[model samples]
Target: MYKAKIFVNYKPSVLDPKATVIQQTLTRLGQTNVDSVMVGKYFELVLQGNEAAVNEQVAKLCSEMLANVNMETYRYTLEEVEA
Candidate 1:
């Protein structure tokens, strides 16, 4: 078995409105230490496959559907899990 941890986030060049709102809200709440904020997607999945195959599938899914390659970037960690 394999475990895949996926993270999808906007590219640095892209503006994140939600994150900006969060930062602004924090500042209003008297949290001026905040410099920036970025929000993204995270998922944990377990697959019944070899490490290589699971990694390939996760990569494909992230690039093709989970994230927009033009505006976002994704990274995953695949690890063998005893099942």
Candidate 2:
């Protein structure tokens, strides 16, 4: 078995309105030390396959479904796991 930890986030050049709002809210709540806030998605998938196959599937899913290639970026880590 393989475990995939995927992370998806907006590109730096893309403006994240939600993150901006959270940052503003934090400032209002006196969390002045927070310079910025970024919103992202994390997914943990347990897949049954060899490392090479799992890696290819993970990359395809990230690009085709989990993230928008034009605006978001994605990365993942894979590890062997006991079923």
Candidate 3:
């Protein structure tokens, strides 16, 4: 078995309104040390297959479905697990 930990996030050039709002809220709440906030998505997938095949599938899924190639980037880590 393989475990995939996927992270999807916007490109730095793209403005993240949600993250900006959160930062503002934090400032209002007296989090003066706050510099910035970034919003992203994290997904955990358990897949059954060989490492090579699983890696290919995970990459495909990240590009085709999990992230928008034009505006976002994705990365994943694979770990072996006992069935």
Candidate 4:
């Protein structure tokens, strides 16, 4: 069995509104060092097959559907699991 952990995040240039909310909350709590916060997505996929094939298929799926190429970037790590 093969498992994939995928992480998707916004690009550096993107402005995340969640950052403002977090900063405001921190300031209310007397913490000023807080700078920014960005939201991201994490996905785990499992496939029953060879490692190489699963990796390729998952990568393709991420590129084609899971991640938005224009403003988001994604990366994945694969591991073998014994059942």
Candidate 2 residue-wise lDDT, 32-69, digit = tens: 99988999999999999889999999999999999999
Model 3, runs deviating above 4 Å? none
TM-score of 4: 0.84
- After TM-score superposition, the amount by which residue 77's alpha carbon in candidate 4 deviates from its true location, in angstroms, is 0.8
lDDT order, best first, reads 3, 2, 1, 4
lDDT of each: 0.91, 0.96, 0.96, 0.87
Best by lDDT: 3
TM-score of 3: 0.96
Estimated TM-score for each candidate: 0.93, 0.96, 0.96, 0.84
lDDT of 2 at 20: 96
Counted clashes in each candidate structure? 0, 0, 0, 0
Whole-structure CA lDDT of model 2? 0.96
**lDDT of each residue in 1-83, candidate 1, tens digit only:** 98889999999999999999999999999999998898999989889877778888998988898989999999999888899
Error of 1 at 1 (Å): 0.7
RMSD of each: 1.0, 0.6, 0.7, 1.6
Candidate 3 structure quality by residue, lDDT tens digits, 10-81: 999999999999999999999989988989999999999999999999999999999999999999999999
Q: After superposition, how far is residue 52 of candidate 1 from its true place, in Å?
A: 1.2
Give the clashing pairs for model 1: none
